[model samples]
Target: MSAVPESNWSAGRPDTGLTPEERAAEQHLELLDRVIGLEQQVAELQSTGLLGPSETIAVERNLAAMRSSMTWRAGRLVTLPIRAAKVVKRRILG
Candidate 1:
């Protein structure tokens, strides 16, 4: 029998020559790792609790990340003013 093409796999899994059950287990492990990573990232962001410019910097970093993404970039126009204000504030405060 012909091996399944890469795209036909569920979850867009690559053809790693593993059996279906093994692939399922591997995907589960991968998903678990991603969840752990996301949790760690959230913890990191939350731990940066600060006030004033430092807090604004943190928010700007998050916004920058969102702006870099294809899907979220749709909202970039809405946030342009906030970014402009930050630029002006930074110049004035510095």
Candidate 2:
């Protein structure tokens, strides 16, 4: 008979190693942090009335491009199933 080796739970701890979902979540947080920092800087600049017309147009263009991105479309599609599941659960419980 062959013996199976036991998993080293401590070695595979979440803090030591990340699963795919955990890695993705970490990346999302990092991106969000960067976005927040940029937003804060923009706000500070605007408060000082230093943000020019060119900068405003550039920000708008970047935002429009992001809104039309494949990642944004995919994210919308990915949430559809979750939204459907929530509707089903609510209908069933009610």
Candidate 3:
């Protein structure tokens, strides 16, 4: 049998072998950081109040467009898994 490479092993690293809970905690912290950053941006925008009514409306419209685009992309991502499952199911059931 070939010897295992040292670089390929994690014999003693606790942090390297994270449990599901630890992985979830790390993801939660990352998401929290993003939320905090968005909050800061909203606060800054509120404080400035620089844009005129028409400009604000235009900004709102642009934001809506961006949100729609993001939703479309997210839907596509979710649909990919569904499509793959359908193909697999068809192959299995036929």
lDDT of 3 by residue, 4-94 (tens): 2433234487667867787677667766877888898899889986988999999999988986797877987889999999999999999
**Residue-level lDDT for 14 in candidate 1:** 58
Q: What are the clashing pairs of model 2?
A: none
Q: Is candidate 1 or candidate 3 better by TM-score?
A: 3
Q: Residues 7-79, candidate 1: write the lDDT tens digits.
A: 4245455554677888788778766877888898899888986568888999999989877998777676778
Model 1 CA deviation exceeding 4 Å by range:
1-16, 53-94
Supply the TM-score for candidate 1. 0.38
* Order of candidate numbers by lDDT, starting with the best: 2, 3, 1
RMSD of each: 16.1, 17.5, 16.4
TM-score of model 3 vs. true structure: 0.39
lDDT (Cα, 0-100) at 28 in candidate 3: 76
Model 2, stretches more than 4 Å misplaced?
A: 1-15, 51-94
- What's each prediction's TM-score? 0.38, 0.37, 0.39
What's the CA error at residue 92 for candidate 1, in Å?
50
- In candidate 2, position 20 carries an lDDT of 74
**Model 3 residue 11 lDDT?**
46
lDDT of each: 0.75, 0.77, 0.77
Index of the highest-TM-score prediction: 3
